[model samples]
Target chain A: AQRVTQPEKLLSVFKGAPVELKCNYSYSGSPELFWYVQYSRQRLQLLLRHISRESIKGFTADLNKGETSFHLKKPFAQEEDSAMYYCALFNDYKLSFGAGTTVTVRA
Target chain B: NAGVTQTPKFRVLKTGQSMTLLCAQDMNHEYMYWYRQDPGMGLRLIHYSVGEGTTAKGEVPDGYNVSRLKKQNFLLGLESAAPSQTSVYFCASSSPGTSKNNEQFFGPGTRLTVL
Candidate 1:
């Protein structure tokens, strides 16, 4: 079965600190990975995709096939960066998502 | 463009009641999806449509029904509401293929609570 796992349920980081949210996925075939974010009172939206290889909002996720991971990383955390992040995998024309990690950047 | 829009931003229902959540997209996307978000359980796909008049069961389709009679609209119906079904429902639409389709534009979401 194809599944995405985000080990952290709640992650707290101090402002200006480096933050990393772990995401691991299991799939039988080549995978396309993505990161989706939802901020308070805002609609869920795409943060980045592995195919694009581009960073969004100062965050970047590298798809590591050898380790079956696609972890999201940010060098400096900001209060505005606090939000829910979901790692997803495109499987058989559908996207499978992880349980999500909520990041809270403390002032 | 409105992108994706879901009706009834907030709804409350008693057990056994029925309701339909409407999703409309102006992007002319060929794919539409319905998902429920619960604490600790991210977004679970309830139902999706690849195109008009073609609906498919997703990761979690039980107790839910979907229709995509119109290309721009997708409807999710809960035959009999249950407390277990209480969650925030989101609607999204995407174009076909693997490249640009990776981006699924989402609606503001509907918060459904069943007592």
Candidate 2:
């Protein structure tokens, strides 16, 4: 079985400040990691995928195979970034998701 | 195109009652999934289908039953509604078996309440 964990339930930061949401996973085989974000009243959407190795909306995540972590980071926070984020792992044909982290970027 | 649409955006059901949630995707993707979202539990897969007429159990499929009679439709049924089953349900689809990365597109979601 595979599991994903998002340690922080809520993370708050001021505008222009850096923010990081921690995620860790436990899988026996190779893993594919992804970050998903859901804004207020909006449907959940993909933020970034580790395979792409590209940043979206100034957010990036590095897959640390050694540590089994894929943490999402943004250099500067914006009020519009406040929303719920989820970390997920794809194994075989199923995707396992973390509990999710809510980010609040205050002005 | 309407990416993925779930019928009955919002529903209220009483305990012991039964209801079925319908999910349709226009992308003609081969893979479809049903998931439930709660406050802190994120999204838990309730059931999934790889192709038409085939259904498989997912992470949380105990109280749920599913059917995939058509290639673009997946239905989730609750035999006896329970308060614990009240949550937001989301339908997602991906063009798997062809795409390597397999990015899933989700629907707006259906909020189900059991009283």
Candidate 3:
């Protein structure tokens, strides 16, 4: 079975501080990892995908096959970055999501 | 384009009552999905459709039913509502392949409460 686990239920950081949200997965095959974000009053949307190897909104996540980890990181937190983040693994044409981490960037 | 839209942005139902949530996508995607979001649970797939007239059960399809009679719309039905069913429902659509990164475009979500 494919499973995604996000260790932190909530994370808080002061503005301009670096933040990292941990994600780990259990899957036998090569994993396709992605980070989805949902802001207040907004719909859930893709923030970044490991295959893209790109950053969005100052956030980036590197897929580590050895550790089976895909942690999201940002150099500096911003108030606008506060939202619910979900780490998902895609397999068999479906996505298995983590419990999610709520990020709060305090000004 | 409306992208993806779900009917009844908010709904309240009593236990044992039945209701249906409708989702429509104008992006002409071949895949549609229904999911429920709850605190600490993130989002769980309730059901999905690969194309018109084809529906499949997902991770948490126990109490929910889905139909894809039309290519552009997918409907989720609950035979009997329960308090545990209270959660925000989301509808999403995506293309079949990885050309679009398999990104699912989501609706604003339907907030359902069963009291």
Candidate 4:
């Protein structure tokens, strides 16, 4: 079975600091990875995909096959970056999502 | 475009009551899905429709029924509501089976509580 794991349930960082949300997956075959975000009082939206290889909102995730991880990272965290982040794995036509990590940026 | 929309943004039902959640998409997507969101459980797929008039069971399909009578609308019905069914329901749509990568578009979600 395919599974997505996001170890941290909540992460806190000061504004302007670097942020990293750990995500790991276990799948039998090559997998497609994605990062989804949900801001306060807003619907969940796609943040980025590994296949696109593009960065969104200063956040980027690189699929590390050797480590079985696709951690989301940002150089400088902003107050607006505080939101819930979910890592997902696409298997055929279905998607498996992680438990999600809530990032809190404080001044 | 509204993208994906779910009806009855909020609802509270007594046990044994029945209701249906409607999801509509204007993007002409071929794939539609219903999922329940719970704390520490993430999103669990309840039912899905690959195309018009086609419905399939997902990871957690028990106690739920779904239908896709039209190309743009998918309905998820709970015949008898239970306390365990209380969760935020999300509807998503994507153009898959034809597109290389399936990027799903999500709805605002419906908050359902069964007491």
Candidate 5:
């Protein structure tokens, strides 16, 4: 079975402050990880993937095989960054998502 | 493209009532999925289809049924709705291949409440 854990249900940060959303995973093989985000009144959308190693909205995540973790981070939090974030693992043509973390960027 | 569209943005069903939720994707994605999101819980897969005419159960498939009669459409059914079944349902679709990295496109979601 594949599992994704976000550990934190909510994270509050001041504008311009750094933000980190913790995520951990359990899988037997080489894994694929992704971060998905859902803004208020919007549908869920992909934030970034470990494979692409690309940053979206100033956020990035590095897949750490040794630690079995893929934590999302951003140097500066923006009010627009407030949304629900989910860590997901792909296996057997399906995605296993974490419970999710709701970020609140207070001004 | 419309991406993915789900019918009946909101619904209320009585206990023991039956209903079907429809999802359609115009992206020509080969894979489609159904998931339910409960309060304070992650989205749990209920059923999925890799292609038309094929359906497979997911982690929480005990109380749901699914069919993919058309490549562009997938339907989820509830033979008997229960209060516990009240939640938001989301449908997603993706095409496989290409470095094994394709993000699923999600619908707006359907809010269901069972009394």
Candidate 6:
């Protein structure tokens, strides 16, 4: 079975401060990781994927195979960044998601 | 394009009742999925379809049934609703080997409450 864990359920950070959301996965083989964001009551949107190696909305995540982790980070937090974020792992044409972290960026 | 769309933005059901959720995508994606979002558990896949007329069970499929009769549509059915079955259902679609990088496009979600 594949599993994704997001240890922190809630994360609060002040504007302009650096914020990081930790994600860890348990999979025996090479893995594909993705970060998805849900803003307020809106639909979930793709933030970024490990294979893309690109940053979206000033946020970036690096996949660490040694640690089996994919942590999302941003240098400066904006109020607009407040949302629910989920880390997902793809295996056999299916995506397994973490419990998710709710970020609150206070001004 | 509308991307993905789901019917019944919100619903309330009684125990033992039955209902079906409709999902439609305009992106011509080859894969469509149904997932239920619960508090603290994130999103769990209920069922998925890789192509028209092909359906498969996902991680949590015990209480749900799915059909992919058409290429652009997928339907999820709950034969007998239970209190524990209440959740926000989300529909997503993705097409591989495209510029999308297999990114799934999601619907707004359907919030269901069982009484």
lDDT of 2 by residue, B20-101 (tens): 9999999889999999999989999999998999999998998899999999999999999999999999999888766545
The two-chain DockQ for each candidate, comma-separated, is: 0.87, 0.85, 0.86, 0.80, 0.82, 0.87
Comparing candidate 2 with candidate 4, which one achieves the higher lDDT?
A: 2
Write the residue-wise lDDT of candidate 4 on B15-112 in tens digits.
99999999999999999999999998888889888899999999899989999999999999999999999999999998975554588889999999
- Backbone clashes in candidate 4 total 0
Q: How much lDDT does each candidate structure score?
A: 0.94, 0.94, 0.94, 0.93, 0.94, 0.95
User: Distance from true position, residue B41, model 1, in Å?
Assistant: 0.7
Stretches off by above 4 angstroms in model 1 are none
Candidate rank order under DockQ: 6, 1, 3, 2, 5, 4
Instruction: Indicate the worst ten consecutive residues by lDDT in candidate 3 chain B.
Output: B95-104
Residue pairs with clashing backbones, model 2: none
Q: Over 4 Å off in model 2, which ranges? A: B97-100
Q: How many backbone clashes are present in model 2?
A: 0
What's the number of clashes in each of the models? 0, 0, 0, 0, 0, 0
**Per-residue CA lDDT of candidate 5, range B2-115, in tens?**
999999899999999999999999988999999998757889999999999999999999889999999999999999999999999999999987543468999999999999
In model 1, state the lDDT of residue A83: 96
The candidate, 3 or 5, that scores higher on DockQ is 3
What is the alpha-carbon lDDT for the whole of candidate 2?
Answer: 0.94
Q: Which CAPRI level is candidate 6?
A: high
- Candidate 5 is graded, for docking, as high
Candidate 4 residue pairs that clash: none
Query: Against the hidden true structure, what lDDT does model 5 obtain?
Result: 0.94
